[model samples]
Target: MSIYSPLPPEMIWEGWEDFKPVWQEIKVNGRILQVEMQGFNQARVVRLLSTDPADYLNSAYQPGCILSFSPQQSTTPGAINDNPPV
Candidate 1:
C-alpha cells in the first residue's frame, strides 16, 4: 500500500496499532448480522450473513446501522442465550 500524502507517517499512522475493535455476531429478525460492539446492549452493524438476497435489502440490516438488543438467559443451565434485537 502506497500513501502519497504530504503528511509524515507519524501523523497518518498515529495510534494505528493501538486501536482494536470488538466484533460480535448477532441475530436479528431471523438474519445473522456481524456487528461491532458500541456499548452495553448496543452494536453497529458491520455486515449481514444471509443466503436470501431479500435479507440484504432490508435497511435495518445495512452496515453502520445501530441495533439495540437484550441478553436473555438460556434454558440450559449455565448457558448464555443468543437473543435477537427487539
Candidate 2:
C-alpha cells in the first residue's frame, strides 16, 4: 500500500521518470541503430550489420524522438544485401 502514497489530490509532482525502453539505440547517419519501441508510437529496425558498406547511412529516423545508440552487430533476418561495388 505504498505506490507513491496513492496521490490523488489534484496531483502535481513532476520529477524522476526518465527511463523506459523495450529496445533503444540510435545514431543514424553515423552508424549504430537498433530501435524497437512500439508502444507510445513506433520505432522499428532491430537489425543492421555493416562490415564496410559505407557504414550504411541514410536513416533520418522518425516517430517520437530520443535516441542514444551505442550497440551494433546484427545480420541474419532475411540477410539484406545488394552488392554492386568492386
Candidate 3:
C-alpha cells in the first residue's frame, strides 16, 4: 500500500470561485490528511493534503484568495505537490 493510504476527512463547503471560507483549521494530531470547516456565514471548505493539516484560523483571509482545489482541479486527481524535489 502507499505510504499515506486513504484520504483525510473532507469538509463540504463552497467558496466564491476562490477558497476563502471561515478559516483554515488543521493540526498534526495524526499522520493523516484531515480538514474540518464550520459555517458562520456562507459556505466554507477545507482540503487536507500533507500529513500536517493546513490551519488558517486567525490567519489572513479575504477576497482574491486563490483556491488550490476545486472543480477546475478535479480533472487532475492527486495533483497536489506538497513534497520537495528529489
Find the candidate with the highest TM-score and give its number.
Answer: 1
Could you estimate the TM-score for every candidate? 0.72, 0.24, 0.20
Q: Per-residue CA lDDT of candidate 1, range 1-86, in tens?
A: 99999999999999999998778887787899999988888899999999999998899999999988897655675445455436
Q: Candidate 1 or 2, higher TM-score?
A: 1
Model 2, runs deviating above 4 Å = 1-18, 24-32, 39-41, 44-53, 60-86
Tell me which of candidates 1 and 2 scores higher on lDDT. 1
Ranking by lDDT: 1, 2, 3
What is model 2's C-alpha RMSD?
12.3
lDDT of 1 at 34: 93
- What digit string (tens of lDDT, one per residue) describes model 2 on residues 1-86? 34565676345344336545576665467656677865454557665545666554435433333444344544554333565334
What's the CA RMSD for each of the models? 5.5, 12.3, 17.1
TM-score sort, best first: 1, 2, 3
Residue pairs with colliding backbones in model 3 are 8-33, 24-56
